[model samples]
Target: MSMSALRRGRKAVVALTTALAVTLVSCSAGEEGAGMGEQQGTPPSTDFFGYQTNSRLVTTNAGTAFGAATNAELLASRLYPAAFVPGPGGQLIPNSDLVTTQEITEPSPDAPRKILYTISDQARFSDGEDVTCEDFLLAYKAGKMRELFGSQKPLANEISNLQCAAGFKQFVVTFNPGQGERWRYLFGPGTVMPSHAIAQKAGLTQEELVGALYAEDPYQLQEVARLWRYGFSVTEFDPDLQLSYGPFVIDRVGPDGEVILKANEDYFGDAPALEQLVVWPRSADTQRLVEDGALQVLDSSTANPTWYDRDSETNPFTLQSQPGDLTDTLVLSGYGLFSQQWARQAFAACVDQGRLAQVSSEKSGTEVAPAYVHVLRHSDPLIPRLDPVTNPHKKTDMELAGQLAGQTIRIGYLGPDERLAAMVQAIKESCEAAGVTVEDVAAEHMSQIHLEIDPETGLPTIDAFLGPVDPMYEYGGPEALIQNVSALRVAEEKLWEDLYDIPVSAQPRTFILDRSVENVVPYTGLSGIGWNMDRWNINEELAGQVTATSEETSEQ
Candidate 1:
């Protein structure tokens, strides 16, 4: 089912359970001033509110909600540093938090390329654990299993006999044969999990610690995998398991789906502007919450359609819309009818892109653009553009579509809702205009579509798949995009080439705060306030603004 529909269904189930007078309470953040002691009017040190999913943490499979959500919260923080960090200008900068300096000491005279990363003395974990060469060895070993083998196993297939060892306060990683050049791309941006703590808990020998990760025994490895999955839980996440070298830490998760976060006092760098952060899940009625003085910051995703109506004098909060990097695209399978570039181009030309955008704007209040490319201002400059207007098959003319009639094409899409339905209907209409017989197949679970390609044909049996692209990690530059595209082209079978995947708009994965919150830095694509719970605080001025606005709206 569509995630939105599933959420709606779950909401109904929760409501039914609630109607039975069942108190559904999970993790509760205790009374504010009780356990932590009294604050002397300088404002409570920890404060923020938000929401969380059912699961706290899970395996980092990239596909699972647990992996995607938790990793976004945990790893992106300064505490768990990656080799490269996203700078202010949305580029991957050097790892300033952990490494003082990095220099490529030796250039390879042979086909293999090599670079050296020198460590600094200043780096330390939150628990005063020195960031050492051993830690890097442990991290690489763990990552090889968890990231490369466990979830993104395809990555490991490209390389042969990857080796690493601790050397004089530095860890040297070398890839075998022709794989050396790809080491930087493979090893960078991975979170270095605490090796000493994890290894000690696992109770394995040093040799076993390094070699057991790549064990051929499936049964033995499954047991070891469980350890990595629940490693944080074993420590009770004490001292805040969501500890960070970053600016924040998870504070509390509430039963009512509210999450609260406070600032990390030990943050290494310049502190953030906002102090407290809160994020409420989709459970609460956002418009009602905004009007009831419960929420301050809102996004285009969560904002109700009614909230954008300028004619509504009863609305208290001002709504601002900005273009984002998210895009909704109609992707075609390279096999079947879509195999021909002209066939795909013909469909694109017939569909009224402007009309589809208008319907989307009406339904969701999100702006839409009429380009095949997903990210805004990021057209493939390498490719020359063709005029859609001048094309013979272009236009919403139904007579033109009749020429391609009787061709059976199945298209898959998410949601049966009005917006998506309108898009589907438009596509069907356009196809019929081109004399094509299109079948609208219901793809309730969009993720499953990724796995549904035929093994023998290597083509997506379904003609098309439509959905939004949430570009979680920013591709730093055109070169990065080129590299990624090239990798996918090399990896993907010939039948999946030239498939459509576009990012249309950008959305800030921000922590929603009550008006009282202050001094929080919003991370893009990371949801939930507790993702960075340590840096949250309550601000009376912001609280008063929410209260006053709610009161005025309620009276109206």
Candidate 2:
């Protein structure tokens, strides 16, 4: 069927569904006291909560060409269901609702490694189309065209081919020999989107889109590329475009960066526990919003000290604070003076990572241990196997940094983050003794690294990036993934030798929950608390009790 015809039929179905819902609600109201609990549904499905985010929503579409994919991934994961999701403690768990079967075939001398995925038959798009292998194919094609899009996940380069018949639920993605060591994460959160939506937006059929993707002519895929790059990225809510197969769908978006989400009634999997979800901008008054019963969840990796200063009596909330999966590092740009390994090493020599970690821990009100490795986090099983002295930059040496005595190193970060700002201050203090000047340039996003290049210096305006780096992407090697601990050790050794990335500390973060909220599990993975937000709900009984107590106190 044509995309427009399908959409028209879908709209008719929606209208019918809405009329039936009204009838059902009317019938239920006659039998039960519907008005008694009408306003009790979490935020009434109409209310918007101001969720304070550390990073601004540059794009809701994660793992796209955008460099802020890490910042947007957590939010984007909520909208699109993936094959696998990061479970507790960073373990890769299959998202059963999306994929029914997933297995990796061992690589042979002749045959390469193959990842076979059997998508759930029940899986569908919010527009009432079946989730087919075409979607995955689109993702594979987009991943390979990184140069066209400007940025992409490292997994894109490992794929040799994607095999599947059109409309088939099962697809096999074959990797080049010795590639895809990290195959489990291929379609994990925010990496894939609905192919039908992209095709429809680009004014092409699924068959035509596939042909364009494989064609030698880049001009054929121009519209497709444009849609893939900037289609879903919206500051304002557009239900027609931002359809969801997941538990919740975007309802409204405010001018001040507030995103309101309502439960997806047509979700094939488990329904969302809460009816409405509000995502506020980073600059919102978080604590005040929490006290006013407007915000129930405050999950942040860079929350301030005031968030932790809460008494149980006055502030009834659960706080889960710990080290996160991301590493806060002072990454050097591969340009200008830092392009040379020795120059990168010299800059790293003056930066005391231990002292930086101390400042980060102190400012963030959490214990952030000094990190030395880029490929693995401190909690990884392979961490102990690696050589202890793999990174020699941990011990700051002023003499080595003196090589760049009069040169100024410009460092940038996704700003307004107090922790990163403190770390930058600490870096400036430590580097001054070596006569090296450190300039702090705060950027709205990471794309500034390539966009604002200085012509004379052959360097980005922001020479180095100071923020969190997902180690999965930072491993230094011809291959993106390492085979084992031994290979990882070698990769880490090479990483230290390159000296471009300086791992400062494992990121420390805290998730605070209001007393009236329930079923919030704190995972240290990139997704954080919102990983299972579809399951999160308002504790209606607790909320009722709190309301009653407040009324009683007022009467007294």
Give per-model CA RMSD. 10.0, 10.1
lDDT value for candidate 1? Answer: 0.43
Per-residue accuracy of model 2 over 1-556 as CA lDDT, tens digit each: 2222322222232223222222222334345221112323333211333345556765666666353433676677778866778775567788888885544766776777887889888888777888888888877787777656544565778888888676888988888887666776666566677778888878888888777776725798887777766777756445666777788778766544566777887788888876677776566555434433455567665544454445423344567778888888776767677877889988988988889889988887788788887777766666656656454545889999999899998887877677788899899989999999998887565542343346786556667877676676544233333357667767788778877788889888887775666777777565656888888766656755555554444345
User: What is the TM-score (0 to 1) of candidate 1?
Assistant: 0.58
In model 1, which runs have C-alpha deviations exceeding 4 angstroms? 1-82, 100-115, 118-163, 166-169, 172-207, 214-220, 224-244, 265-267, 270-276, 302-318, 327-359, 371-556
Candidate 2: which pairs clash? 51-280
| lDDT, candidates in the order shown | 0.43, 0.67
Please report the candidate that would top lDDT against the real structure: 2
Residues 182-278, candidate 1, lDDT per residue (tens digit)?
3433333334555545555557544555565545444544544554444443114444233444454445443443444445555565564455454
Off by over 4 Å in 2: 1-51, 65-70, 100-104, 108-110, 164-166, 215-217, 301-309, 389-391, 448-459, 473-483
In candidate 2, what residue range of length 10 has the lowest lDDT sum? 32-41
